[model samples]
Target chain A: MKFSIQKDRFAQSVQDVLKAISSRTTIPILTGIKIDVTEEGIKLTGSDSDISIESFIPQEEEGKILAEIEQPGSIVLNARFFNEIVKKLPLDRIEIEVMNSFQTVIRSGQSEFNLNGLDPEEYPHLPQIEEREVFKMPTDLLKTIIRQTVFAVSASETRPILTGVNWRMEDGRLVCIATDSHRLAMRKAAVETDSDAEYNVVIPGKSLNELSKILDDTKEPVEIVITDSQVLFRAKHLLFYSRLLEGNYPDTSRLIPTESKTKLELNTKEFLQAIDRASLLAREERNNVVKLSVIDQDTIEISSNSPEIGKVTEQVKSRSVEGDELRISFSAKYMMDALKALDGTEINVQFTGAMKPFIIRPEQDDSTLQLILPVRTY
Target chain B: MKFSIQKDRFAQSVQDVLKAISSRTTIPILTGIKIDVTEEGIKLTGSDSDISIESFIPQEEEGKILAEIEQPGSIVLNARFFNEIVKKLPLDRIEIEVMNSFQTVIRSGQSEFNLNGLDPEEYPHLPQIEEREVFKMPTDLLKTIIRQTVFAVSASETRPILTGVNWRMEDGRLVCIATDSHRLAMRKAAVETDSDAEYNVVIPGKSLNELSKILDDTKEPVEIVITDSQVLFRAKHLLFYSRLLEGNYPDTSRLIPTESKTKLELNTKEFLQAIDRASLLAREERNNVVKLSVIDQDTIEISSNSPEIGKVTEQVKSRSVEGDELRISFSAKYMMDALKALDGTEINVQFTGAMKPFIIRPEQDDSTLQLILPVRTY
Candidate 1:
C-alpha cells in the first residue's frame, strides 16, 4: 500500500481499531492491524477473537484531499508500534508505503520508520453476518443505556453468561438489563426501527463499554444489526462487531419486588454523599455494608461500623417517609453506583422487608430502575 | 480537645501532614496523626520515622476566625480514617471533640463519627534543632532545585548515600547535586542567610520530593535549617522535618569532562522531540539507548534500531556545530529528562568523545549542568 494521509484523522482511525487488538492473543497476526487500500478509502481492521473493529479513512472529504493513493495494496503492521509512531510523527501529513518482501516505510516530515509488516493474507477473516434486520437508535441514548446497566454485570467468569447485558427489544421499545445476583440495573428506552424483528441477545459488558467510548455523544443515528452469534454496530466511518454470549440469560423479571411495605423519597445527591461517608469506614470490611434505619416518618439514619476503626452515623431528611420502622444493611458501593448512574435529583426507594431486595427509581420516571439485595446483618 | 474549624482549610492541613504518614511504618503509633489544641490554634502532626510534618491551623487569620477553640488537650487518631472523614464532611465547619476513655466525636452537619483515638503520650517527639543559623530562599526556587535533581538520584539501596542529594553552601551560593553513577544533575542558586554559616549536607531525595509538593509555587521565602542529624523547613503555619542520610557523600566534581572534541548548539525542544520519537523503538531494549550521528556542520541524525521490531531515523537541524565529527549513544530517558528540566529553548552540548561523558547546559547559563555517560555501541 502506498498512500499519504492526514496525521490527526489517520491516528484517530488507528486508535479506534486498536481498541479491539490485544497483545496476549494466541494468534500472532491478531495482535497486528490489517490495512486494505482500494479506490474508495483505506480500511483498518483489528480483532481479538471476541470483538472486531474496522475504521475507514476516505481519500477525500468536504472538497479536501485527506489522502492520495498511489497504489492499491494491503499489509498488516504491529498495532502497538504503528500507533506510537503515528501519534508522535513530526508533521501533519504521514505517508505509508509497502515495498517488496512486505517491508513498510512510514514517512512524515523528517522522520522515517521502516517496519517489517506481515502478509495481510495471514490475518483471519472477520465473522460473516448477513444483515437481515437493522435497528436504528440515537448514539447518545444507546450510550446512556449501556452506562446505566453495564456496571451491574458480574465481573467473575464462574457463570460467563452473567458478564453480559441482555438487550430485549419488542413491540416499539428496548430494555437493557444487567445483574450480578446481588443487584440488578434495568433501563428502558423508546427505539425507532423499520422492522418488526425482536432481539433478546446478550452482548458482553466489556464490548458495550468499548463501543460506548468509541461512539460520539450526538443525536446521530447508529445502525445496529444482530445475528445468531454476532452483533454489529455501524457508525459513519466505523464498524464494531461483538460475539454474543453462548448460554441463555437468566430471567430476571420475577426477581424485582412488586410491592413494598416501606417507601421514602430523598434527594439523590445528598443521600449518595451520606452513603459515601458511611462507606469510608465500611470499606475496610469485606462487604462494605452500611445500615439504614428509619427513625421517624420524616427522617432516617445511615450508619456503618468497623470494630477496629470507628463508626459513622448520618441523618438525612426525606421529603416523606411512611411505613413500619425498619433497619436494613446493604452494600454501600452498590447504592453509590446506582445513585451516580441516575440522572435526576429526587429518587424513590421502596423496601419489602429488611432481608428482601429493595428498588430505587427516579421520582417522576419509571424507565430506569435499580435493585439491591439486603445483607443479613441482624 | 474540642474545636470547630473551617472544613476546607482544615482539610488542606490534614492532607499536607498525611504525606509524611505511611501505613507501612515500623512503629504502629506512627500511622496515626497527633492533634494538639492550644489557646492559639490546632496542630496536626504525622510521621513515618524518617520524616515528620506538622501543620497548624490558627484560631484566627486576617481578622477572620478560622477555628474556635473551646478546650485545650491532645489526642492521636488513625491518620487514614481521619483524613477520609475530614474530606467528606458535609458542612463548612467541622467540630472534633475528645470525650472520656479516648473516644473522639467528629460532627459536621447531620453526620457524626465516633473514632477510637490513641493516647497522644505515646507519639514520638520531633527532633529538636537549635536555632543557630537559618537560610531563606523563594519557595518556587526550592521546588525547582528539587525537581531538577531528584529524578537523577539512585533508586537502589545498595549505595544508600546515592539515594540522597548533596547540598553544599559556601560564599553566597548553594549547589545541589544528584547522580546514579551513570549520569549527574547539578543546580546552583544564590541564597541569603541570617548568619554566617557554611554547610554541606545530604538530604534524602524522597524528603525533598515531599517538601516540594507541600510548598506553594509563589516566590514567598521559606526558612531552611540544617543540623547535625536533621534538616528543618519552616513555612508559614507548617514545620517539615527530614532526617539526613547517615553516610558521607562521594565527590562527583571530577566526573564531568572539562575539555571537549566536539561542541554543538541546538534548539532544546526540537532535539528533545527527535530523541523522544527515536526512543519509541529503543525503549524496548534493556538500556533504552538512542544514537546521534553528526551528518554535517548544521545537521544531525538521531536513530534507534531493534532488530526484531524495526528502526527509526530522524534528521534534526542544529543552530551550529563545530569541531571534530562525532557519534555517540546515550539513554534516551536521561536526555529527555535533562531537556525537560532546562529553562531556555537554546542549549549548548559539549562532547568529549564517543565513550566519555557529555555535558549539556543552557546557552548562556552556567548555573545548571547535566552530564550524561555514553554507552558503548560497538
Candidate 2:
C-alpha cells in the first residue's frame, strides 16, 4: 500500500477503530489494525471477537483531496504503536508505503518511521448480515437511548445474558431495557423501519457503551441492520458490528409495577443531590443503602446510618405527595444512576408500598422509566 | 469543635490539610484530621509522620467574619469522611457542634451529619522547630524550584539520601540539587535570610512535591525555618512541617563537566519534540536509548532503532554547533525531563565526550543546570 493522506483525518479514523481493539484478545492478529488502500478510500478495521469497527477515509472529501493513492494493497499494523506515532507526528500530511517483507514506512516532514507489518489475510473477516430488516434513527437519539439503559446492565457475569441490553420492537416503537436484578432502566423511541416486523435481540452492554462513544451527537442518521446472530450499524463512513448474546433475555416488563400506593413529584436536581450526600455515609457501609421517609405531606427525609461511622440525614422538599404515607430503603448508587438518566426538571416517583418495587419517570415525558427494588431495611 | 464557618472556606482548608493525611499510615489517628475551635479561630491539622499541614481559619479576616465560634473544643475526625461531608453539604454556612460522648453533629441547611469523633489527646503533636535560622522567598519561586529539581530525584529507596533533594546555602544563595546518579538537576536562587548562616539539609522529594501543590502561585512570602531534624514553612495562615531525611548527602559538584568537546545551541521546544518522537520507538526497547548525531554545522539527527519493530529518524535544525562533530546516545526520558525543566526559547548543550556526562542549560539564564550521563550504545 502506497498513499499519502491528511494526518488529522487519518488520526480520527484510527481512533474510531481503536474502540474495538482489545490488547488482551486471545487472537494475535486481532491485536493489530487492518489497513486497506483501495480506489475508493482507505479502510481501517479493528476487532476483538465481540465487536468489530471499520472507519473509512475517502480519497476526496467535499471537492478537496484528502488522500492520493499510488498503489492498492493491504497490511496489518500494531494498533498501539501506530496510533501513538500518528497522534505525535508533527505535520499536516503523512505518507505511508508498504514494501517487500511487509515493511511499512511512514513519513511526515523530516520524521520517518519503519514498522513491521503483518499480512492482512490473516485477520478475520467481518461478519456478513443480510439487510432484510433494517432500522434508522438519528445518531443523537441512538446515543441517548444507549446511555439511558446501558448503565443498568448487570456488570457481574453470573447471568451472562443479563450483561446485555435487550432491544425489542413493540408496535411501531423501539424499546431498550437493561436490569441488574436490583434496578431496571427502559427507554422507548420511534424509529424508521422497512417493515412492520417485530424483532428482539440482546446486545452486550459493553458493545453499546463503545458504540455510544463513537456515535457523533449530530442529527445525521445511523442505519442499523439486524440478523440472527449479528447486528451492523452504518453511519456516514463508519461500520460497527456486534455479536448477539446466545441466550434468552429475562422478561422484565412484569417486574415494573403498574399500580402505585403513593406518588410524589419533586425537582430532579434537588432529589439527586440529596441522595448523593446520603450516599457519602452509606458508601462506607457494604450495602450502600439509604432510607427515604415521607414527612408530613410535602417533605421527604433521606438518611443513611453507618453503625461504626455515624449517620447523615437530609430533608428534601417535594412539590406534591399523594396516596399512602411510605418509607423505603434502596441502594443510593442505583437511585443516583436512575435520577441522572432521566433528563427532566421534575421527576415523578411512584411507590407501590414500601416493600414492593418503585418506579421513577420524567414528569414531562413518559418515554423513559426507571424501577428500583427496595431492600427490606427493617 | 462548635462553630459555624463559611462552607467554601472550610472546604478549602480541609482539602489543604488532606494532603498530609495518608491512608496507608501505621497510626490510626494520622488518618483523621484534628479540628480545634479556639476563641481566636478554627484550626485543621493532618499528619502522616513524614509531613504535617496545619491550616487556620481566623474568626475575622480583613474585617470580614469567616467563622463564628459558639464553643471552644478540639476533636479529630476521619479525614476521608469529613472531607466528603464538607464538600457535599448543601448550605452556605455550616454549624458543627460536639455533643455528649464526642458525637459531633454537623449541620447545614436541612442536612445534618453525626460523626464519631476521636479524642484529640490521642493524636500525635506536631514537631516543634526552633526559629534559629529562617529564610524567606516568594511562594511561587519556591514552587518553581521544587518542580525544576524534584523529577530528577531517585525513586528507588536503595539510596535514601538520593531520594531527597539536597538544599544548601552557599555564598548567600539557596541551592537545591537532586540526582539519581544517572542524571542530576540543580536550581539556585537568592533569598532573604535573617542571618548569613550556612545550612544544609535533605528534604524528602515526596514532601516537597506535596508542599508545591499547596503553595499558591502568588507574591506572598513563605518563611522557611530549618532545625536539626525538621523544617517548617509558614505562609499567611498555613503552616507546613516536614521531617528531614537523616543521612549525609553525597557531593555531586565533581560530577558536572568543566570542559566540553562539542557544544550545540538549539530551540528548546524543537529539540524536546524531536526526542519525544524518537522515544516512541526507543520505548519498545528495554533501555529506551535514543541517539543524536550532528550531521553538519547547523543540523542534528535524532534516531532510535528497535530491531524487531524497525526504526525512526528525525532531523532537527540547530541554531549553532561548535567544538567537534559527535554522536552520543542517552535515555530519552532523562533528556526530556531535563529539557522540560529549562525555561528558555533556546538551550545550550555541552558534551564532554561520547561516553562522558553532558550539561544542558538555558541559553539566557544561569540559575538552573541539568547534567545527563550518556549511555554507551555498541
Candidate 3:
C-alpha cells in the first residue's frame, strides 16, 4: 500500500488514535496501531481491552486532497514511535509505502524512516456493535457531563462496578452518576434520543476520561450506539468504543437525602477559597479533614486542626441561612472536587444533621448535585 | 516575635527559602524554616545541611511598609506548611505574633492560623564568612553560566566531585566547568575581582541549580563571598550559602582536544531538531546513539538504526564543511544538550577523528564550549 498525505492532517489523526494504543506489553501486537487502506479512504485503529479509538481520513476533504491509495492493504506499526516520527517530519507532505514483507517506509523533506511493521491480520478486530440503539447528543454537553462526574468514581478495585460511571437515560433526558461511597456527583441534561429506548450502562471512569480528552470542543453532534455490552460514540471522522462493565450499578437515589434541616447559600468561589485555606492545616492531619460550622444567619466558620501542626479558622459570609445551626467535617479533597464540579456562582448546601450526609447543588438549579458524608471528629 | 508584613512580600520570601528545604525529613528541625523578627526587618531562613537560603523583608522599602516589627525574637515553623499557608492567606497584610510556649498566631483578613513553633535555638546557624574575598556580577550572568554548564554534571553519587561544577577565576575571568566524564560544558565570563587573588571551588550542581532559580532576572548585581569551605551569595535582601564539595575536580582541559582534522558549521536550531528526530528511532536501543557523517562541503548526514526498530536517515545542509569527511556516533542526548547550551545562529563542530572526542562551539562567540566523546558502534 502506498499513500501521500498532508503532514499536519496525518499527524493529528495519528495522535487521536494513538491514545488508545496499549502501553502494557502483555499483548505485544496491541502496542501497534493498525492502518487500513480502502477505496473510500484510510482507517486507523488503536485499542486496548478496555477501550478503542479509530479515526478515518477521507480521500478528499473540502475539495482538498487528503490521501490517495495506490493499492488497498493493511499494516500495523508501533504507535508511539510512528506518532513521534510523523510529528517531527520536516515537510508539508508525507509519503508512506508498505512493502510486501510488511516493511513500512515514511519519507518527508530530506528525512526517511524505515520501520518494522506487523501484518494487520495479527491485530485484534474492532468489536462489532449494532447501531440499533443509536442516539445523538452535542459533544460539548457530553464532555461537560463526563468531566463533572468522572472525578467521583471509586479508584480502588475492591468493588469493580464502582470504578465505572453509571449512565442512564429516561424520558428525554440523560443522567450520569459517579460515586466512591465517600462522595457522589451527578449531572443530567436533555438529549435527542429514541423515546422508547433506555440505557443503563456502566463505563469505566478511566476510559471515559480518555474519551473526553479525545473529544474536541465542537458544536457537532455525536452519535452514540449501544449494544448488549459495548458502547460506541461517533463524531465526525472519529469513532470511540468502550467496553461496559457487566454488573448492576448500586441504587444511588436512596443515598441522596430527600430532606434537610438547614440550608445556606454562598458564592462558590468564596466558599472554595475558604475551604482551600482551611485545607492547609487539615492536610497535615491523618484524614485531611476540614470542618464547616454555620454560626449565625450570615456567618459560616471553616476550621481545621492538627495536634502537632496547630489549627486554622476562617469566617465566610453567606447570603442566607435557615434552620438549626450545624457543624460538619469532611475530607478537604472531596469538598474541593464537589465545589469544582459546580458551575454557578452561588451554591446551596443542605444539612440534615451534623452526622448525616449533606447535599450541595447550584443555587438556582437542581439538575446537578454532590453529596458528601461527614467524618466524625472529637 | 510580633510583626505585620505585606502578604505578597512575605509569600515571595517564604517561597524563596522553601527551595532550600529538602523533602527528606531525616532532620526534623531542618524541615522547618527559621524566621527572625527585629526592629530593622524580618529574616526567613531554610536549610538542609548542604545548602541554605535566607530572605529578608525590611521594615520599610522605598517609603512603603514591607514589615513592621513590634518585638524582636525568632522561631522555627514547618517550612512546607508555612509556605502553603502564606500563599493562600486572603489578606493584603498578615499579622504574626509569638506567644509563650512557642505558639505562633498568624492572622490575615478574617482567617487566623495558630501554628506550633520550635525554639529558634534549635535551628542551625548560618555560617559567618569573612569579607576578604568578595566580587559582584549581574544576577542574569550568574544564572546563564549555571544553566549552560549544570546539565553536564554527573548525577551518580559514585564520583561525588563530578556532581559539582568547578568554578575558578584566572586573570579576572570567571570560568565554570562541569563534566560527567562522558561530556563537558564550559562557560566563561569576565567579572570584577582582585587581580592578585585567584580562587577555585567546586560547588554542588544541585545547589547551583537552586541558586539559579532563586536569582531574579533583574539588573541588580549579586555579591559573591568565599569562605574557607562555604560560598555565599548576597543579592538585595536574600542570602544564599552552599557548602563546597571537598576534594579535587578532575582536570577537564585534557579531555577537550585543541586541534581537529574536520570541522562543520550548521544552524543551531536545525541541528537540534534533526538530532531530536533521529533520537526517536534510536530510543529503543540501549545507548540512543545517532551518527553524523560529512557528505560534502555543504551537506552532512544524520542517521540512527536499530536492527528490530529499523532506521532513520536525514541529510542536513551545512553552512560550511572543511577538511576530511568523517563519520562519528554519539549519544543523541549529549548532542542535544550541547546544542541547547550554545545559543547562536550557527554552531561549529570540530572532529579530530571518528573515534576521538570532539568539541562544539558557536561561530559568533567563544565564551562557551561543549565536548562529547564518540561511541564505538558495531
Candidate 4:
C-alpha cells in the first residue's frame, strides 16, 4: 500500500477511529486499526468487538485533491503509535508506503518513521446490516437526546439492562428513557422515516456517550439502521456501530407520579445553586442528602447538617407554591443533574408526598420529564 | 471573632492559605486555619508544620474599605470547609461571628452557616525570625529563578538533600543550583543587600513550588530573610515561611568540563522539536535514549530505535558545526526540560567526549546553564 494525503484531515480521521480502539481487548489484533485502500478512497476501521468505528477519506473533496494513491492494499498498525506520529509530523503532507514483510514507512518533510505492521487478513470483519428501515434525525437533536438521558443510566453491572437507554420508535415518534431505579430521565422527539417498521432497542449508555462526542452541532441528518443485534449510525464520512444489550427493559411509565399534593414553580438556576451550596455540607454524609422545606407561599428553605461539621440553611424565592406545605430530603447530586438536563429557566415540580416519587418538567414543555425518588430521613 | 469582609478578596485569601494546609497531618489542629482579629485588621493562617502561609486584610486599603471589624478575637476553623463556604456565599459581603461554645455563624444575603470552631490557642505558633539583614529582589525575577531550577530537584527521597535547591549568597549576588545526580540546572541573580553575611542554605523544592503559586507576576520588590532554620518571604499583604533542610551541599564547581571535543550552535526551537519527535520511538526503551549524530559541517541527524517497534530519524540543520563528527545518546526528557528552561532562541552546545558530561548555555548569556550526562547505548 502506498498513498500520500493531507496531514491535518488524515490526523482528525485517525483520532475519531481511535476512540473505539481499546488497549485491554480480549483479542490482541482488535487493538490495531485497519487501513484499506481502494480505487475510490481509503477507509480506516477500529473495533474492540463491542463497538466499531470506521472513517473514510475521499480521493478528492470539493475539487481539492486530498490523496494520491499509487497502489491498492490493506495493512493494520498499532493505533497508539500511529496517532502519536501522525500528529507530530513536521509538514502539511505525509506519505505512507508498505514494503515486503509488512514494514510500513511514514515520511513527512525531513522526518521518517518505520513501524511494524500486522497482516490485515487476521482482522475480524465488521458486522454488515441491510438498511431495511433507516431513520433520520438532526445531528444536534440526537446529541441533545443522548446527553439528556444517558447520565441517568445505572453504572453498576448487576442489572446490566439498566445500564443502557431504551429506544422505542413508532409512528414517526421516538421515545428514549433511562433509569437507575432511584432517578429517571425521558426525552421524546419526532424522526423522519419512510418505512413502517418499528424499533425497540436498548443501546449501552457508554456507546451513546462516545457517539455524542463524535457528532457535530450541525443540522446535517444522521441515518440510523437498527437490527436484532447491531445498530449503525451513519454520518457524512463516519460510520459507528454498537452491539445491542439482550434483555427486556423494565416498564417505567407506572413509576412516574401522576397526582400531586404539592406543586411549585421556581427558577431552575436559583434552585440548582441553592442545592449546590447545601450539598457542600451534605457531601460529608454517606448518602449526600439535603433537605428542602416549603413555607406555604412565603419562601423555600434548603438545609443540610453534619453532626461533627455544622449546618447550613438558605431561603430561595419561588414564582408560586400551592397545596399543602411539605418537607422532603433527597440526594443533592440527583436534583442538580435533573435541573441541568431540563435546561430551562423555569421548572414545574410536582410531588404526591414526601415519600413518593416526584416529577420535574420544564415549564410548557411536555416532551421531557425527570423523576427522582426521595430518600427517607428521620 | 466578628467581621464583615468583601467576599471576593476574603475568598482569594482563604484559597491562598489553604495551599499550606494538608488533611493528612499528624496533628489534628494543623488541619484547621487560624483567624486572628486585631484592631488593625484580620489575619488568616494555615500551616502543615513544614510550611506556613499567612494573608492579612487590612480594614481599609488605598481609599476603599475592605472589612468592618465589630470585635477583636480569634478562632480556628476547618480549612477545607472554610474555603468552600466563603467561595459560595450569596452576597458580596459576608459576616462571620463567633457565639458561645466557639460556634461560628457565617451569614450572607439570606444564607447562614453554623460551624464548629476550635480554640486558636491550640493551633501551633508560626516560627518567628528576627531580620538582621534582608535581601530584596523583583517578584517576577524570583518567580522566574524558581521555575528554572525547581524542576531539576530529585523526586526520590533516597538522598534527602537532593530534593532541595541550594541557595548560595555572597557579595550581593545569589546563586541557586538543583540536580538529581544525572542533570543539573543553575540560575544566578543580583539582589540588594547591605549585610556582608555570606550565607548558604537549602530550601525544599516543594516549598518553592507552593511559594511560586502564591506569588503574582509583578515588578514590585519582595523582602526575603534567611536564618538558621527558617526562611521568610514577605510581600505586600502576604507572609510565607518555610523550614530549611539541614545538610552540607557538595561542592560542584569542579564537575563542569572546560575542554570540549565538539561544539555546535543551533536554534533552540528547531533542535527541541527534532528531539521531541525522535523521543516518540525512544520512549519504549528503559532509558528513553535518543541519539544525535553530527555530519561534519553538515546537517545533524537525530534517531531512536526499538527492537520490537520500528525506528525514527529526523535531520535538523544547525547554524554552525565546527567540531569533529560524533554520535552520542542521552535521555530525551532531560534535553527537552533543559531546553524549555533555558527559554532562548539560539543555544550553544559543547560536548567534551562521548562519556563525559556536556553543558548547554543560552548564546551570549552566562547567568543560566544546563548540564546533562550521556547514556551508553550498545
Best by DockQ: 1
lDDT of 3 by residue, B219-293 (tens): 799989876699999999999999999998877777888898999989998899999989998986648899999
**TM-score of the candidate numbered 2?**
0.99
Residue-level lDDT of model 2, residues B1-378, one tens digit each, is 589999999999999999999999888889899999999999999999899999999999999999999999999998999999999988899999999887999999989999998889999989988768788999999999999999999999999999999999977799999999999999999999868889899999999999999988999999999898999999999999999999899999899988888999999999999999999988966488999999999999999999877799999999899989999999999999999998889999999899999999999798999999999998
Candidate 2, superposed: residue stretches over 4 Å from native: none
Which ranges of candidate 3 are over 4 A from the true structure? Answer: none
* Per-candidate clashes, comma-separated: 0, 0, 0, 0
lDDT tens readout by residue for model 1, A1-378 = 799999999999999999999888888999899999997889999999899999998898888998899999999999999999999999999999999888899999999999989999999999998968888899999999999999999999999999999999999689999999999999999887889998999999999999999999999999999998999999999999999998899999999999889999999999999999999999866479999999998899999999888899999999999787889999999999899888899999999999999999999999999999999986
lDDT tens per residue, model 4, A1-378? 999999999999999999899988888788788999887778999998888999999999999999999999999999988999999999999999999888999999989999988999999999988878899999999999998899999999989999999999978899999999999999999999988888889999999998898888999999999999999999999999999999899989899878899888999998998898888888866478999999759588999999788999999997999888899999999999999999779999998899999999999998899999999998
Better of 2 and 4 by DockQ: 2
Any residue pairs clashing in model 1, and if so which? Answer: none
Chain A TM-scores of each predicted structure, in the order given, are 0.99, 0.99, 0.98, 0.99
Candidate 3: residue pairs that collide: none
How good is the docking of model 1, as DockQ?
0.91
Q: Compared with the true structure, what per-residue lDDT tens digits does model 2 show for residues A1-378?
A: 899999998999999999999998888889899999998889999999899999999999999999999999999998988999999998999999999999999999999999999999999989987768778999999999999999999999999999999999978799999999999999999999868888899999999999999988999999998888998999999999999998899998789898888999999999999999989988856489999999968999999999888999999999999989898999999999999999999999999998899999998798999999999987
Which DockQ values do the candidates obtain, in the order shown?
0.91, 0.89, 0.88, 0.82
Residue A278 Cα positional deviation in candidate 4, in Å, after optimal superposition: 0.4
lDDT of 1 by residue, B1-378 (tens): 899999999999999999999989888889899999999999999999899999998999999999999999999999999999999999999999999978999999999999999999999999998997899999999999999899999999999999999999988789999999989999999998867688889999999999999999989889999999999999999999999998889989899888988989999999999999999988876479999999998999999999877899999998989899999999999999999888899999999899999999999999999989999989
TM-score of each: 0.99, 0.99, 0.98, 0.99
TM-score of chain B of each: 0.99, 0.99, 0.98, 0.98
